[model samples]
Target: MFRKRSKTTENTAATASTAVRPVWTFSSSGWLFLYHFGVIKCLKDLDLHRQVYTIGSSGGSCAGAFLHMDTDIDEVVRFVLSCALEARSSFSGLFQLKRYLKNAIRKFGTAELPNKLEGNYEISVSQLPWLRNRRITKWRDMEDVEQSILASSCAVPLAGLPVNVPGLGYCIDGMFSDSQLIKALVLGNSYFAYHDHASVTICPFYSSRAHITPSEYVPLWWAFFPPSPEELWRVYKLGQKDARAWVIKNRGRTNLTVTPIPDLTDEPEATVLQDGWHAWENVGEEISMLATGAVARLWSALSHVLEALGWTLVYWELAVHTVLSAVVAALAPVLPDSLKAGGSTAMAWKRCRDYYALLLSLKMVLKMVPALGGRIRMGMDAIDRIFSLSFCFRLFWFLKQSA
Candidate 1:
């Protein structure tokens, strides 16, 4: 889930009054995961440049002008630590919530992934002969139920997924070019065709079962992207990395595996499922270090570009959450009765911690103002403090005292 910056002018009175709330999210082909062109255009409409701020960046519009251009290993470590600390605050939580809530409200009542095919609900406006239009109408509010209707959803190399009809041919890198077949995938196209219960696979993986399984869209995203195991090794090789050499040099050990592609068909054109790439996932080399180094290279390049543009990483805290987690984690150690009281005690602790933080922050303000002014002040302060944590730390200390 994410919050979009309000379209309202950042300087406007109403814009100043916006409250932080959680944004609701749904995985879909229609939204969030737009096509390449769509995403470039959508980014233009976002609040990223004008209303957004980043404390450290390489190339985006809001890269902080204050960013130190001459960065070293130490600086990167410092920045990462700062980012991690900032993420754990109360205000950051609000940002997440507000983004989530705003997204939820903005995208409420939209279509969702299906649970299965031919189970219930309709897809693509087709009123199958066996069902009345009212039966489908009754389920418009339920996206999952609607998605289950004989949609052509696609699955990937993942061990488990919904099945409509198995692919007649295996797709390389999980790409599907077939129009009718691809359209069946909720991740591919939103189109659907009418099929009677007998024709339908009734399995959740079938994209044809649109109304049958709406939640299936998320896995589709990973299938669309992410490197294949082959690509992972190729990338490492192309980058002049040699974890294998390091392993041989240090431990005289090399992990090897014979991955076999599953032959699902008998034809010449049949693609194979390159399973048993367990060696790649299970390699004993410095795999994590290699992966991290590769990612860092890209991130470093991007950071440099964004930094040149004055973008900075914006940091915020969800503090009501910040201390409550600590209290919850430490309760078992500090309190003799904590284990016996169980998880509920920690939950209750969080609820009260949140309430008290809110109350305390409210009381910090002058009490004589009218309700509107007070609200405005609180909203403005919440917005202000999101950009910095000095005030939050003070509040954190106050909350601890009360606790």
Candidate 2:
């Protein structure tokens, strides 16, 4: 969609002419290392990685280390796949896998790691107590850098324990704070006096801030389980595809003097006038899609509630009948013999007991209905998943783009 160039865009263009470096920011991609690995491979293939600035968080930090060190592409891929397998094997195996990854980072990582002031690499981590996100640029040595990477990648309650940064108390995943990479980018920009405007944001999930065309959202199971070879290959290829699309999209804006970019002459572009019209059309389409999806989901929920209510009414009717029968049976024996001539106390009591049993069964069935007992458990889970990024925010983005 065409958007009128804002002050940010204007500044970006102005900075682009003055040999601005491309800033590659990576999101906290848990277990999706291969995805960012693929993007790195593509960027390197296009000769874009050499002069780029890197900002990463969580799994992205790990990949940033690789990029900073210019590690072997194939080796990084193999190491990532192996780490995934090791982590998925057992709980203890995850610790072992972390150690292995740390060693790998230390082996490749230089003694002097990148920081905001001097280097092209920075890793973000969530600081404890206040629970704020901060970038680690300066390090004691490669060992410190490795530990920082561990702390950044450590997702509490799931992956492993939070690593305690020497002065930062117990630090967890950078995602606890800057899950979207917005804060990191802002900090990165400010460090460069806002001259570093050439941004290539790569989110593992589909994000509005990313340059690449959004890929399929990764399932939560992939975070804990090692993907099969076929699945891994698919994600890798998807990354490559999106990276290429990013190159094509930004080819027109990049400065030619920095590096020789591949000429994607066959790719088409729309004029400024066309863009405005198309932008409005896109907006309309997105609005309609969102409205339709909302209506459909509401209808589905309503139908489920109505069905449960219908079943509840049937069960309640039976329960009411049982209660009335039980009362009559119990009262029948206590009534005058003239009024209840055919009823025996023993039979009446038995009938009352039977009615009580029937009432219990009806109560159990009522609780089973979705509108009743099941709601509590399901509601809690739904809320948890929604807040925990399990419920894909990309669904809305996907719907917007699908049209």
Candidate 3:
């Protein structure tokens, strides 16, 4: 005969269970980062894959579809990288208005992206058997629905061509409809709880770092322009306010953890996209930064001491290298034309690699020495100052170039 568990023990067990399962929700920016940079690996590393319920719009939707399909992260990264590389190569040709319009028409007319997604990632709808009695009957119909959802998520105005769904009207960007974190949480909680009695803690990640300054905005044709610096700043502030409000509103009911990517303003490498079609041309780099930022934030949120410390070190290394590389790149453009040849580029790359290797060696040495972590932290702080100065110099250079 077994004795019954006490009420206190049951409560403790429930608390422990809840602490282990977190439902992850990705913003458009976060999703793009994960899509290109091993979302599955990150989730698995954190042991969050099985318990996660993802929600995303625009680029994030693409990630959500991949999760739903249970597709391997390796394949997702490959597909996203290939697409990014193709887009990068086609950037120059896309500058011509005629070619741009022709490509847009061809892409949207054939629902090229949606078709591609369906072909590459579609799986048996029987996996989601709960929805069998719903309007979607056949597996092909379910595939179409999933593809339509992804297409709609990525349909950014002016930047991405909209697709038409059979049942729905012309689909635009998902942000217009579902940018709020609360909606995703509500859906995830309700669906998962109903199905499995699972209690989900929301982990929301976004990449809207308030780094773009007023001075960063250069005058461009109004028709083809992004929001003004002031407007962008205002929107970012309002978004922060909204996020805070969300936290306050959801307090004590659902455990919501919000992780926003750190500002990239002081990263000299970020300026490389200044001359291009800002967001579109630098998609890969932006995605990479977003992924790194997310990882840094996630590292801070971990409960395991060893894992946290290890990831924190990784974050610092990535941060240091990013700032240093940007500084080098920024200074490169100021060099005399005679010094800007292939040999210079190769030399610069080798020097950067060697410098980073030295930093790694230093890290290993510090690990061997007791109580040296504090010294390493101090060194990081010093590097932060350097990053700030380099960023300021880069900004001044840009102003001169614009003038």
Candidate 4:
């Protein structure tokens, strides 16, 4: 009886220690960090944080740190709110947010990071112009951590520049690499080899069960221009509410997965319906290409015509006014002072001349207001690139080969 009881206890202990751990992965979410805070609170409430391992990329790195530490949720809320307010207070661009982030991290960041032994956490970043993704589990000091977080958050064109980390080289946003399915597949294969855990992804924006399209559009927009305190609070609460629902539904679950939203540039998988070649199918494609190209060219030509007509009207108006002013000056002697508002004819004529010159100067400067021509050209170019006939042909050929 004693031997059986000891065996039972040992089995339970082994299961408790070696059971599949929860791997929580967070994607980069700028001001949307509030949503993550709410989710983390839900996890902590259920005493699940102790059993969860975290992986974060970009802005997620900051959230991941908070999750790893014994930090209060309220403290994190205050931190997030304060950071957003400060970053958005004096500026109107994402670059300002970057500056404020660096300053805040330097002021408040500590040189000591909690060891993975304390709680497993990983940060992801992409080395610029070359490598798409790299995950770091160890850090040398406060600066490294700060740089890593900033590097991961760097979105090209939108956010000013990629961060230069001492050992990581120049790096951009981690989302750029993982946004691709092929890259994500590679990462997944490698991730399972080293980490013996089941991952649960909690996305605040969109999910298969929920289609929050409006929220999907604002992830970066909010970072560029942080919303009102009321809106931020609402989003945070929504995240908490969603997370609680998720927990209720997925309680005692061992495996969970969340799909990342694809960007506009992400290549979709090519599907082939038939194995045999059909040359006749090219007719519809060719027709589509011709129609789209003709429409684009027509629009471009119309814009140019309108612009020219607008300028011609402006010039004509100026010429007509000049002729009228000259006629007025010539007839000033014959005209009554009442026509000039009780002023002398000479004074009225001088004022008229000055007004004509002012109008002429202003009209000339209208051309300097910035050219719509370049904008029209840019639009046409975008249409050509996005709806190119060559791309369609290439896609058709690929599908044929794949089939």
Candidate 5:
């Protein structure tokens, strides 16, 4: 007898669970930190089987994740127990690991080297997964760099157009204005550069051990190609446009001219776009510095002004505003946490606030597709240059005024 075919075949195994993820302050602190804290939570609960984790400083609403493989929290707790046992039995130094981590982070962060951070984080987990085989080596590839070590101040490229000097000059003139000074500072400081459009030229006035080098020195093999850039462009594997622009800008030729590239077949060559990525990635950091620095200074002044206006909760408002800013920055590519490394708690808070505003501006700009991103990036970049100069100016002013 033929059996009737069923409309549905059923075997019960629910699709893997994916919970709604929680957002973090982004790079302000990596969420991988949760793994550091979460397992401790499970250990504290004496639940071992419910938590397994992985974390990193990559992009995200969260830094990393913790998973519970088996349904039992107690089973998870066992790993933490093992780690504790190993620490007590074979690695007694584990007692001081937390202290070491705290001190190291504090020192590395602000250079002030505080004894420790004061905030506490809590996580609850049921179990611990054994540490998997992992490789932790410091091998930053050149392609990871996308940041221009040589900022606009010392290195800028012209788009090569009929630029109106008066218009550009007016732009410069406006920047020198008190309000515009802030604007310029915010934009230009990204990679600080100045332009004298009348001469149709731009120059870099800001640099900090910043150098611009290709990911790998041009391949020596390319040197044998025709001395013309067009040929070298193909053999050197240089970007179709940027490489040509660099040659023209640096070699001082406007139209395509035959140019010879140097060669040393024996010189060491690195691999890939890794360095370019790193360079580009640093753009976020530069943007943040200019943004935060401007906001911290301006908002502080604004706070005083608001206080005079008898606005209550001025400080509280500042705190809220700043936290919001930092969260926004966390979501963006990069924004500086503060003007310099290891800034004060107050300073970091200010950066966070600025980051939020910057992120908002970027989000608005991105709403219109690629145009806004490019234009805003360019405009803010100009402001960043101005910021670098103004920062120096402010320092000098403070020094002289104090003296």
Candidate 6:
């Protein structure tokens, strides 16, 4: 006959097993980075997928919503890519009368994104009947909650309009209340803690320098959009300070680990769609270097190739000229009659001027390509500094024009 294990020993064994499952917390910045650069898949490969609890504000929340679906990471990447392409096409048509007319007509049939997300969430939850039974009170109630969450996640001050939930008043980005990591930790602890024992290790990833600048805010309309770079800086700094303080305060009591990721916003290789690519590259490289497996080596090689392609697409400068040409064509009709005999003639002249400018810019960029490539070969930091300087010059020029 086998001897029965003591209750204390059984409890200890259970606790030990639970302790191995880490609780992953992602910041708004971290989630966006992971989503954009395909690093979320790497988490599964690294065996860090268990007990993941995500919370984010703004773009982070957008990423979180995708993650919550429990679908394949590739599916999430495809969804993000589709959304980005849609946004690009929509914005490209802003000055085009024909496209604007088409968009206006289309708007009636299309629901706002928050509504779409709410409906999607309801359908997703209904499919998972167990989750619906466990958490949802009523379908309507669940829809409302999902809507509020999506709206709040997208509530950037100037970039996104504030959303009014039934009872929450004017909800904005959740970051205004607390950093993403802190909120996730508090929620996870409250819900998952039992008998004064934590079931998982909380690992929060964040970037301290994820502040927004004035140049980064592209206005949707010609409105009195307030310039708040100073305010954004202040908030970002305060959040970083408070986050560190909170981590220190709860260090030993809570099984918390904070991982500070490098900020890639100012990097030359990053782009609006793939800003987190550099960070993901660094992570993949580090892992590949440390691991001995052939799989790791293959992943590293693929990641490098993808990074090169992404950089080429984002920085080629020809795409900028193409967009400018379209803008000129669209705006020609609105120009003063003095500019040309007719809208068609005006458009032709504008196109000619743009093409000339594009040729000149292309020549300059091509000439600098070798130098830029050399600097990149030397180190990414060097390229970043050069890019930062150019960005500052452009920002100054914009400010001068605005003033």
Candidate 4 lDDT, 1-403, residue by residue in tens: 0011121121111123334566676666677766777777666766677776676766666766666556677666776677676656665544565665676566545555535323366666777677556666566667677777787777765566888876667988776654533211211111111111224654444211121111221233454467766566656665655666666556546443323322313422112212323322232333344566778566555544444444344444544544555665667688653232213556545534643563455433343233343232223342222222122232433433333
All candidates in order of lDDT, best leading: 2, 4, 3, 6, 5, 1
For candidate 1, the lDDT comes to 0.24
**Global lDDT of each candidate:** 0.24, 0.55, 0.34, 0.51, 0.24, 0.33
Q: How far is candidate 4 from the true structure (C-alpha RMSD, Å)?
A: 28.2
TM-score of 5: 0.16
Clashes of each: 80, 0, 2, 0, 63, 0
Candidate 6: clashing residue pairs, number: 0
Whole-model lDDT for model 4 versus the true structure?
A: 0.51
Error of 1 at 40 (Å): 38
Error of 5 at 139 (Å): 27
Q: Over the full model, what C-alpha lDDT does candidate 5 score relative to the true structure?
A: 0.24
Lowest-lDDT window of 10 residues in candidate 5?
Answer: 146-155
Q: 92-160 in candidate 6: lDDT tens per residue? A: 422232222123223322324333333222110111112110111112343354444444343243334
lDDT of residue 29 for candidate 6? 37
Estimate TM-scores for all models.
0.16, 0.55, 0.32, 0.51, 0.16, 0.31
Error of 2 at 350 (Å): 73
Candidate 5, 163-270: lDDT as tens digits: 112111101111111112322333222221111001111111112111212322232222111122222222223221222334435444322232353332442322
Error of 5 at 275 (Å): 6.9
Candidate 3 Cα misplacement greater than 4 A, ranges: 1-21, 34-37, 45-47, 92-142, 157-160, 179-403
Give residue 267's lDDT in candidate 1 (0 to 100): 17
Candidate 4: residue 253 lDDT (0-100): 61
